[model samples]
Target: MYICLEGIDGSGKTTQIKLLESWIQKCGIDVLRVFEPTDNEVGKLIRKLLQNPDAINENFQITLALLFAADRTVLMRDITEAEALAKIVISDRSFYSSMVYQNDSEWIAEINKHAKQPDLVILLDINPETAVSRCDGMDSFEEQNFLASTAKKYLELADHQNFMVVNANNGINKVHDDIKRIVAHKLGMCI
Candidate 1:
């Protein structure tokens, strides 16, 4: 099973991933936790670009999207290996993030055409204001208007059967419980 968790900054995706990892382990399942941009060479470039505001400009979205696609291609190989090992792969982000963050262009879709889709995509839904308040530092894409737009795009691309939008405003435990329920149902594991 390939499970993905996505949300804007401060939406608690990292926290939930950790909790889910523990829960899945307790269920006697081997879980492979992967994150994008991965720790590879291309991923390193993406991380640097993210931290250096001056390195990004109007065309940054296009560049970043392509980099993300490259990183995902590398990640796909790892995912296949983990799956062959019978481990459930859980990713922090995936192509859905590109669809939400990048410009609405066919190029974005083309870049990610070869990427594998997640069996389940859990989108942690939170208002931009709330998300901004929860975050300590803002990235280029984490600004109010940008996050608002990203959130809108996520909703627009959401598929009811494959996607679940969990209210991130809820307390951590409550949010985790909600995610756990969804993951359990999808994976056919008892929670």
Candidate 2:
């Protein structure tokens, strides 16, 4: 199963992912934990550019969209080719995030063209205001208008089809429990 966890920065996706992976492993499932904007050469440059917001001047939006797409493509290919022994692949971020960053409505229509869809897309839903304060003053794509826009986009995307939307405003353990419920329901695992 391909399971993806997505949300704005400071939404606790990174923390919860570790917990989720551990829980799944304890159930005797082999889990693959993968994250994007990888440490690969090309992805490294993209990460540097994205972090230095001031350095972006030309085609900034397109640059990030393409960079994320490339990273997802690499990830998708690798995961698909892996042996089935890895029962579940949990990704911290996935192609849906690119759609949010690009803020393109066409993304929803063309989403499947880029990469394989996940069996379950777990959205850690948090309002943009809460998301910003969670960052503790550091500014990034997740703190500004981008967060608002993306959160809206995510809602719109979710409305089109059924996906798990877990409220991330609560404490970490609560959020983890919610995710466990969702995953158990989806996979029909003993809870």
| Alpha-carbon TM-score of each model against the true structure | 0.92, 0.87
Compose the digit string of candidate 2's lDDT tens values, residues 1-191. Answer: 89889888878889999999999989988888888776676678788887776644546866666767777777777678642565688888877777665656475336436677888899999978788887887566635777887787887777765668999999999999999999998889868
Candidate 1, poorest ten consecutive residues by summed lDDT: 153-162
Decoy 1 TM-score against native: 0.92
Clashes of 1: 0
Clashing pairs in 1: none
The prediction achieving the highest lDDT against the true structure is 1
Clashing pairs in 2: none
